[model samples]
Every structure is written in C-alpha cells, then in structure tokens.
Target: MHIFVKGAAIAFFSLAITACSSNPDDGFTGKESADVLYSDARTAMETGNFAKAARTLEQLDSRFPFGAYKDQVQLDLIYAYYKQDSTADALANIDKFLKLNPTHPDIDYVIYMRGLVNMQADSYFLHDLLNIDRTDRDPQNAQEAFKDFNRLLKSYPNSKYAPDAQKRMQFLKDRLASYSVKVAEYYIKIDAWSAAAVRGQTIVETFSDTPYVERALEIMVQAYGELGQNTLKQHALEVMKTNFPNNALVSQR
Candidate 1:
C-alpha cells in the first residue's frame, strides 16, 4: 500500500511540473520572436491597452535588447508609461534613451516629449477640478519643463516640435514669472524689503516679456520705498510708466 501511495505522489508531482512549465500565465518563455512581440505590443497600444502594451514591450526589450525594434520599443514604452501616469518610469526611460542615442534621428521628438512629461508632473488634479490657482506652490517641475523645451528649441531650431515647444515655453515663462511675483509679494507682506526688491528685480530682468513684469515693478517700487531708497524707487516707477503707462501703480506714484 505504501509503495502504491509513493508512485501516485510521484506521478502527480511530475504532472504538476509539466502543467506549470506550460502555464499560459508564465510570461514569455522565449517562444515568440521579437517581431511577434512587437506586433502584439503595437496592437495593445492601438487598442488603448497601455498596461498590456507596456508589459509586452518590456518583455520584448529584455528578450531582444539589441533587436531592430529596440529604438521603437523604447519610444513606445516611454509613451506607454506616460499614459499610465508612471512619470518616474517615463523619465528614467527617456534619460536612458537620450544617454544611449544622443544622435538618434528622433532625438528631437524625445526631448519634446520629455518637456511635456515634466510640464504635467506637478499637476494637482484637485486644483484643476476646483479651478484653484497653484501659482504659489513650488514651480520646480515647471522650471525643469521650461529648460527642457528651451533646450529642444535651441538644439533643433527647425525641428517639427519647435513650434509646439515654443508655445509651451511661453506658458512656462508666464507661470514662472507669476511664481516669482508671488514670492515677491510674500516678502513684501513679511516686511523683507531687500529680499522683495531682489525678487522683483529678478522678475523684471528674467521675465521682462511677461505681464507679471508690471506687478514686479510695483513690488520693487514699494520695497525700495520702504527701504528709503528713493533713487531705486524712482527708477522702478519710471520703468513702470515707460512700459505700462496706464497702470494704477504708476498713476499713484
């Protein structure tokens, strides 16, 4: 009876091993070729199944690191991660691709996408839903995005992405200018006249093209006035009048 039980157990264990080996859930047993995997990934992406697409692409990458589809796979994976809201993963892959393929034909598009990703990295869904202003928050991500877009434009002036990147740079400029203005306002509120004046000066010089320059000049005027720097205050007032003659602050001065 004992011998029969052992034989039955051996038979069941062998069958279980065979079943596990052939399990469909075991992803990528090296059976599918790179082309087949690429096709599967493309179909998933086209169908808006980015999760599946990412998984399949990752498998393909591991299976065929130097395959003909390597570049396209990396690009698609970046987009998939972006769609999945996996910002860190997307950025990591972007950096990796850039490091390895600096002179690749599609480098311009990759840089443009990097800027887009950074632009939305710090977005607050609740703030958008409630129509709340986020200018007072830290603008680090916006700054990075601005630099990325700027690099793209400077490095590839005739790139197809330049026009869109220029537009995004404009938006980021306005946002960064607003953030500086907010900081100047905070310094003014706390009676930090020198700091406020410096911040306002930075805004005037760095963001002279933005609408916030007017507010920055006003802040500088007030801060210098509080510091008893009459000459500096007059200079700020003069610039404000020259640029924004109809501004109420200019009128008051």
Candidate 2:
C-alpha cells in the first residue's frame, strides 16, 4: 500500500508539471514546446490558416513572455492578426511594437505597416462617427493611408520605398479630390454658394494637377453666377479658360 501511494503521488506530480507547460501547438509541452508551437504557427500561416496562426502566436506570447524569440513572436502576431482581418488588433500590436522599439532599424517598416492597417480599417461597412450607414461610401482610409506613406516619402524620400509611396500618394489625392467634389456639390444643393466656392477654389489650388480641378472650376463659375456676382463670375470663367483653354465650360460661353 505504501509503494502504491508513492507511485500515485509521482504520477500526479508529473501530470501537474505537464499541465503547467501547456503546448501552444499540440502535445509538445516544455521550454522546447515554444519552438514546436512557433513552427506550427508558421506552417499554419503558410497554409493560409491565418486565424489559427494568430491564436498560436498569442499563445506563444503568453507562454514565453521573455523568450529569445519573443520579439519575433510579437511581429508574427501582428502579421497574423492583419492576415486574419483583425484590423484593430493588428494596429494595436503595431503601435505597441513602435512604442517599444522606436529606434529599431525596422521602425520605418512598422510605420509603413501602420498605414496599411489603417487603410484596411477604413472599411465601407464599418460604422461612421456620425452613426450613419456608410455601406455605400468608401472609407476615409485612403486619407490616413496617404499620411502614412507620406511619412516614408517625406522623411525617407530616398528610401527604396519612396517611388511606391509616391504612386500611393497619387491614388490618395484622387480620392481626396473626389471627396471635395462631393462636399462642394452638397453645398450647391443647399444654396450655400459661398461654401461651394471655397471648396471649389481649394480643389483648384490644392489639387491643381488633378482632373478634378477642371470640375472644380466649373463649380466655381456656377457658384459665382448663382450669387449674382458677374465680376467674380467673369473672373472665374476667364481663369478657367486661361488654365484650361479647351474647357467645356468655355465652349458653353
């Protein structure tokens, strides 16, 4: 009876130790279990099991909070969250990485990723600040995405990523120009001629390189005419003609 009790006690202790070393993967549990779990997570990610990969990475982070692979684990967790379409989690983890490693050589990569995450988060299906249905509209993600790309464009203009950033900026500019047009048209419908004029002129001045400027000038001409300001109207018309000689508005004149 004494030998049997000792054996039972030893078995209980072994099981307890194993439970404390819970495997993030399958049955492999120990300090070495971390390696196995990470390997499995990498395999999961490669197989496009992004959600499972994220969970595994989370487990690694929780289990080995101070391992040599902790930083890599954190990075993988961020990517896994991003791949799994968890924008909030991805952005939060990216922010945590930036705060903790501000001077890391890969800081720029993190900022670039932040921009990408925000771009994804600015979803058409997401609730807006105004509590209105935004399902039909493009999210403001493009604006934030531009800001992030511009950080790399401006601060590291000579960076290898600069050219791609410039292309992205142009895409952002087009969307922003479209947004201004929508706002200006809204003002026009409300008989807010002054506001429309301001918005139109801003597009003309700020986004002169875009085709939207042509449309903006047309709106400006209409706003001035509606307000019964012939001089301003004539000036706008002339400017439109001067800038865009073949402007359709000029042909109508």
Candidate 3:
C-alpha cells in the first residue's frame, strides 16, 4: 500500500511539471499549431475583437517564430494594437516591421500606421467636442506625429495615404503654431517682453502659413513696445498691415 501511494504521488508531480512546461498560450488555453492560431487571430481581428486578436497573434508569434506567416502576422499585430488604442504596442510593432522588412510592398501603409498611432497620442478630441482650446497643452506628441506624417510623404509622395497625411500635418502645424502664440501671450501677461517677442518670432518665422501668424504679429508688436523698441514695434505693425490690411489693429497702425 505504501509503495502504491508513493508511485501515485510521483506520477502526479510528473504530470504537473509537464503541464507547466507546455506552451502557455493564455488566450488559446491549449497548444495549437501556428496556422490554426493565425486563423483564429484573423477572425478576431475581422470582427473588431482587437484585444482577442492581439492575444492570439502574440501566441502565434511565440509558438512559431519562423512560421510561414511571420511577417504578415507582425503587420497584422500592428493593426490590432492600433485598434486596441495600444499606441505604444502599435509603434513598437511598426518599428519592428520597418527594420525587418524595409522594402516590403506595403511599407507605405506601415508608415501611415505609424503616423496614425502617434497622432492618437495627442488627439484634438477635446477641441472638437467641447470647443476647448488645446493651446496650453504639450505639443510634443503633436510634433512627433507631424514628423511621422512628413516621413511618409517624403518617402512615398504618391501613396494613397499621402493626401490625408498632408492634411494631418497641416493640422499639427496649426496646433503647434497656436501653442507658440499662447506661450508668447503668457509671457506678455507676465511682462517678459524679450521672451514674448522670441516666442512670437518663432511662430512668424516657422509657421507663417498658419492662421495664428496674425496673432503672433500682434504679440511681437506688444512685446517690442513693452521693451521700448519702437523700431521693432513699427516693423511688426507694417507686417500686420501688409498681411491683414483690413484688420482693425492694422487700420489703427
């Protein structure tokens, strides 16, 4: 009886170890071939179950790193991450795809995806939904997104995504230009005339195409006047007149 009990205990321990050593694909809950896993992941993604898709794709990648569909799986993972609003994951996968398949036929789409992921990191939802200004918010992510879009356009000018990327880039420029104007206004409020003038000058020189250029000129005029620089103030006023002749401020000049 004692010998039988000991043997039973040994067998139970061995089974537990085997289970532990098995592929722990959490979503799958059982070991499955890469093709089956990939098919499951594709179905989940098509149905908009991005969270499930991400989990299954991760399992497929782990179980079969050298699978026939490895490259395509990684690309699909990027899309899944984006749909899940997992921007960090999406960007990481995009980097991997770029490095591994620099000349992939769908490289333009990958570049477009990178821009979309970064764009979501700093969306204009608040401004669009609530009419709230985002001028005081950090524009770092916006700048990153702009660079991403610019890279796509520079590399694939005729890409189907180029038109939308261009529009997004212009929107980012406007947002950044407005942010600069807001900073200059803040400086003006604090009586930091030189700093205010510098901020205003940045907008005028760097983002001349944005609508905030008019407001930037006003900031420059005010800052120069506060700093007792009459010549600079006159120069700003002349610029306003040249660009916005009908503006009341220009009329006053």
Candidate 4:
C-alpha cells in the first residue's frame, strides 16, 4: 500500500509539473476545475507530495486570482514551496500574504518560517572561504542571510522562533565582525591603510559588543600607523583608551 501511494504521488507530481509548464494558449485545456485543483493540491501537501502541491498551487494562484480560494490557496502554496526548498519563492509569496491578510490568525507562522529559512542559508565560513575567487558567487549572501534572521528577531521578539532567532543572530553578529577584520587585513596588506583603518573603526564603533573588538583595535593601530596621518591615528588610539581601556594591545602600543 505504501509503495502504491508513493507511485501515485510520483505520477500526480509529473502531471502537475506538465500543467505548470504548459502554456495556457496550448490546445489542451485543464481538465481539473479550480475547486478540484485546490482539493487535490491540498491532498498532495497532506500526503507529503510537496512538488505536486506546489505545481497545483501555482496553477490556482495564476488561474484564479479572484477565485474564492485565493487567500487560502496562497497560504498553502507558500508552505508547499517551503517544503520543496524553493525558499525564495516561499518568502516572496509570504510578503504577498502579509499584504493581503496582515491580521490573519497564523501570521506568526510566517515570521517563524522567515527565521527558519535564514537559519538554513549557507554559513559565512563557506561563502567567505570557498567563494574567494568566484566573483560570480556573491560573498554578500551571508550578510543577506543574517539580515533576514535579524529582521525576524526584531519583529517577532516574542514569537515561538524568537529564542532560536536570538541565538542565530548572535552567531551571525560574531561572524560578521570577524569577517570585517579580515577585510581590514586585506586592505592593510594592499597599502590602502586609511581604508583599512575605517573598516577596523567600524568594528569598534558599530560592533562594539562583538568579540572582535580587541582584534579590530589592534588592526586599527597598524592601519593608522601605515597611513602616516598622526591626527587620525591619534583618534584611533583614543578610541581604544575610552572604549577598551583594558585591551592588551592598547598597552602594548
């Protein structure tokens, strides 16, 4: 029975994909009416046939914009996309759902899923280490991922995902600060000392709470010295005295 059910799901998914990819102007009109499509799509989702559910939901959303099931279908479709790891599409539709039904009872689910997708995105280490030479690969994808998690933390501080979001946010904050230090190091090595100084200063000023503060201050000393601007260098030194008085590097200098 289980094997039969799986086989049926595979066949249903194949047909749904064909329906989604086929042009409306094609000769074969859809045999399943919108209501019937909705029923079948939901049945697919309940049975773990995510791809089939997504395809049918896509048809419902496009073909029945003004259909009575528009709102419900949109919500179900987002979940379908999420289950299929089409997270970008799921999130886009989530924004649409919020715009249409801001006061819906399940709004918290949207916020929770937003946090979940951000958490699922690739970590900074993979992007920073592996994509160093791949100019086509965006190094900023990590930043975008963290921003998404932070948004969830900020907006849904009390939601069920809040505790997990907060934990994820801290991890992001630490990694971002460390990555900034590496950028500063790169700039310092390439003789762009002032640029390096500013990047280090940003870590001190903006990410003062992060674990990277001491390292940034140490790098700032070298960056500012190489720039040969005593006045700006003095400012960087003062930041250490005021902000991180006990930072070991401060005394070493």
Best model number under lDDT:
1
RMSD for each of the candidates: 13.6, 14.7, 13.7, 8.6
Total clashes for model 2:
0
Per-residue lDDT for 53 in model 1? 87
lDDT, each prediction: 0.89, 0.79, 0.86, 0.72
Clashing residue pairs found in predicted model 4: none
Off by over 4 Å in 1: 1-30
Those runs of model 3 whose alpha carbons end farther than 4 Å from true positions after fitting are: 1-29, 124-131
Model with the higher lDDT, candidate 3 or 4: 3
TM-score of each: 0.87, 0.77, 0.84, 0.65
Q: In candidate 1, what are the lDDT values of residues 119-157, reduced to their tens digit?
A: 878676546644579888889889999999999999999
Ranking 2 against 3 by lDDT, winner = 3
- Tens-place lDDT per residue, model 2, 1-253, is 7567666766766875675455455543546578888898899899987767877778788888888778888788887877656787988898899899878776677777777677667653224322454433563777778888988777777766678778867876776787889889989999999999999999988888777988998999999999998898898899988989998889899
